[model samples]
Target: MAEVLLVVGVVVAMFVAYNIGGSTTGPAFGPAVGAKAISKPVAAGLMGLFFFVGAWTIGRNVVTKLGTELVVDPGVFTLESSIAVLFFIGIALLVGNIFGVPASTSMTAVGAIAGLGLAGNVLDLAVMGEIVIWWVVSPIVGFWVSLIIGRYFYARFNRMVAMERSTGPLLDVDRSGPIPIPRVHETTNRRELVGTITVVAIGCLMAFSSGTSNIANAVAPLVGSGELAMDPAIILGGIAVTIGAFTIARRTLDTMGSDITELPLTAAIVVASVSSALVVFLSMLGIPASFVIIATMSIVGLGWGRATRPVTVPEAVRKEKAPPVTIDALAADEPGEELPPIGEEDPDKIPQASDLFNPATTARVVLMQNVVPAIATLGAYLTFRFVPIFGI
Candidate 1:
């Protein structure tokens, strides 16, 4: 019976790790894939590699916290309790995937453990409060930081473009023939070099941070139950997460990259960087956080805030204007010239109203994207809260 239960617990842990990969990898690789900077397969492969490295190197801290630190007593988390936690988190992630939301596996794990701890009389209200507070603050901090960075970069780009325009080199215009091109000096600028270095550094940091903070989400329960040692847990968790990233992370990636907001590479880097910093900080402090919510909100808020204005249709496409109909002057007088039948009304004509009011669709898509993730988080919480009575 003990062996059977252990096997079951391991299976549940694997499911939890798979869900983590689906939720977290989407954010980690979504922007790069959406920007066309990398293909989905390449992103998945890279994420898998980095995730393993991260889990092995720095994931120990988070794993220890999740398995041992949050509650008043570690003995309260029995095999049954661990399985219950995994079930709740897994259900929540499954719901998020179905609804196309990028829910946070970290949040789900925290909520489940908290619920279980309360049931087992091991609740530590002080630690729980701190964790909840970070949950609230992390996303807000991520958003404003991303917003500031995005705006500053945009301003700098505009200034550079304006300066180049003012330099006003002689232009060759041809009225009747092609103009000859002139060769100019090719040199990299200090700004470009600095920006490139900063972006690469941030990417590395984000990858490392993600791997470290999320390791606990998968391996903590197993460790708590003495089913696995720290080193083996980290190795298993890392490999499992990498596999999850490569297989199930694509849909959520599309939702984040294309549906929430159209993020430029720079804006993506800023959001990812800010989110990673917050996650790392929380992990170090032994606080639990939701990375998906933080990263998604940051990217969406930054993208929306940076848009020049709400999208509007061109005047030529508005519905108020009547379509111009031409009647040939000669055809009007000649009865013998048969009037061409109004070309069969095309069924595939684009709706003018839709074109003008396109922002509504964008808004709906964004709302759904955000709401689905939140619902998933809540679902995980509720599942664990009611698990004792439900006997899951």
Candidate 2:
């Protein structure tokens, strides 16, 4: 019976890891793949490799936190209870996918574990409190950092990172010897090649950050239960995530690249860098940071900051009339074009923020994202506390 239950637990953990890869790959590599900087297969391959590197290193800290420290007793994570926790997380992932929203795997996983801890009377308030505090603080930091960049440095950074892809293949295979060697095509200039490499490198960084923070979301419970050792659990989760990257991630790459939000490549890079850095920092502290929330706030802050650039602080304080708030500020200046002094740009070019994003739609997305995790918490709690099946 124990062996069978352990098998069930492993399978559920894999399911959770698979969804993590599918959802996270887009955010990590979408911009690079979308920009034609890298092929989807290459992006997926890089994602898997870097993800493993992260999970094997810094990710262990997060697994330890969630699997042991978050609860008063690790024994609460019985194989049966662990499966229930994973089930709730899997449901959250399914809901996010169906709604065309990428949910926070970290938040959902934490919620489920918290629920189990609460039901078993093993909840550690101090640890949960610290995690919650970071959750609130990290996104705000991402927003502000992105906002400052968008307002002051974005134009310059954009100009530097911008690339116009020239015709011809980026690389060619030379079959001159027994082993073929790949070389940059002659037509690909230095600037374009460098830009391409930068984009792909940023994608790898995002993938590494994702692995650091998200691996625990898949296997923490099993590890906590002592059914699987930490190294084996991490390896299993990494493999499942890699499978997901190669499979379902193709659709996400399309969605992130073109559909959900049309972030300029520069803006995508900015957001990815800021959010990935914050997530890595949090993961180092054994915190499961919410990449979705951080990235969303970063996008909003970048747009808002750019939009507000038409009004200088002094002018606004003096009650000088300013242009309406708008995200169109992002497009007001072309990459590499000289930006006018702050508050000097024509107001006529910027559209209202409402034009870029509908409040109703935005509210719905934010609400639904929170609601899914709440459901996971509530459902897990109910199953453990009220139901006798899990023996909680």
User: Best by TM-score, which number?
Assistant: 2
What is the C-alpha lDDT profile of model 1 across 282-360, one tens digit per residue?
Answer: 7777665666667766765554333311222242246332332111110111212222222222212312221211355
> TM-scores of the models, in the given order?
0.66, 0.94
Clashing pairs in model 1, backbone N/Cα/C closer than 3 A: none
RMSD of 1: 14.7
Report, for every candidate in turn, its global Cα lDDT versus the true structure.
Answer: 0.61, 0.86
What is candidate 1's local distance difference test score? Answer: 0.61
Residue 358, model 2, lDDT: 59
Off by over 4 Å in 2: 177-179, 317-327, 349-354
Q: Spell out the clash pairs found in candidate 2.
A: none
